[model samples]
Target: MNDEEQYSVWPHGTPVPAGWRSTGFSGDETTCLAHIDEVWTDLRPRGLREWLATRS
Candidate 1:
C-alpha cells in the first residue's frame, strides 16, 4: 500500500514498482486478501491527512 493506502497486486516474483514496499507477507490469493483485511483497517484511497482534510 502507498501513503494513500491504495494497493495493487502484482504477480509473485515480479519487481515492485517505485514508491512501494513489500508488506513482507506472501501467499495464495485467499491468504493475501485475509492479510490485507486484517491490516488495512482504513479503506480510503486518500492518505490519512488528506482524508481528514476532506472530512473537515
Candidate 2:
C-alpha cells in the first residue's frame, strides 16, 4: 500500500517502491489478489475519497 491506499503484488525479494509499504501479507499471486479484492472494497483513491467526504 501507499499514501493513496492502492494495493498491488510485488515480488518477495524485491525492494518495495519508495512510497509503498507491504501489508505484511505474502503469498502466491492468486492469494495476494484475493486478499486485495477482499480488503479493497472501495476503488476510489484516497484523494478522491477525502474530497467526496468534504462534499458530503
Candidate 3:
C-alpha cells in the first residue's frame, strides 16, 4: 500500500506483525479480505475462534 492508503494499525512503513502480514503491494485492485483473514488467523492460532474451529 502506498503512503496514501489507510490502515487501522498498520502505519506507514510498519512491518507486518508476525503472521499478520502483507507485502502491502496488492496492486491487482482485488479486495484481499480472505487473504487478510488467513493472515490474521495465522497470527492468532491460539485465538478463541481459531481454537474452536480447529476442534470442529
Candidate 4:
C-alpha cells in the first residue's frame, strides 16, 4: 500500500520484480511519470539485476 499521500510511483496490481524501486513522488504527476521512466531504465526484475541487492 501507498505509505504517503504524495505521488507514489510504485507498480500496482502486476507483480513487480526485485531491484525495482518505489519512488516517493511528491504528487507532481508530470514529474512522477518522468521519474517512473527513469526509474524503469535503471531498474530490473527480481534476480535480474542488482539495485538493492541482498544476499540470503
Best by TM-score: 2
* Candidate 4: residue 17 Cα off by (Å): 15
Give the least accurate 10-residue stretch of model 3, judged by summed lDDT: 1-10
- Model 1: worst 10 consecutive residues (lDDT sum): 1-10
lDDT of each: 0.76, 0.95, 0.45, 0.46
Candidate 4 lDDT by residue in tens digits, 1-56: 12221223543454534544444344455776876566555444444444346542
Over the stretch 1-56, how does candidate 3's per-residue lDDT look in tens digits? 22222222454455665545445535222345544554554343355556689899
Residue-by-residue lDDT tens digits, candidate 2, 1-56:
99999998999999999999999999999999999999999989999999999998
What CA RMSD would you report for each candidate? 2.5, 0.6, 8.8, 9.1
After superposing candidate 2 on the true structure, give the runs of residues whose Cα lies further than 4 Å from its correct spot. Answer: none
Report the C-alpha displacement of residue 7, candidate 2, in angstroms: 0.3
Q: Which model, 2 or 4, shows the larger lDDT?
A: 2
Q: Which residue pairs does candidate 3 place in steric collision?
A: 1-24
Candidate 4 ranges with C-alpha deviation above 4 Å: 1-22, 50-56
Off by over 4 Å in 3: 1-8, 23-56
Query: Deviation in angstroms for 28 in model 3?
Result: 18
Superposition error at 29 for model 4 (Å): 2.3
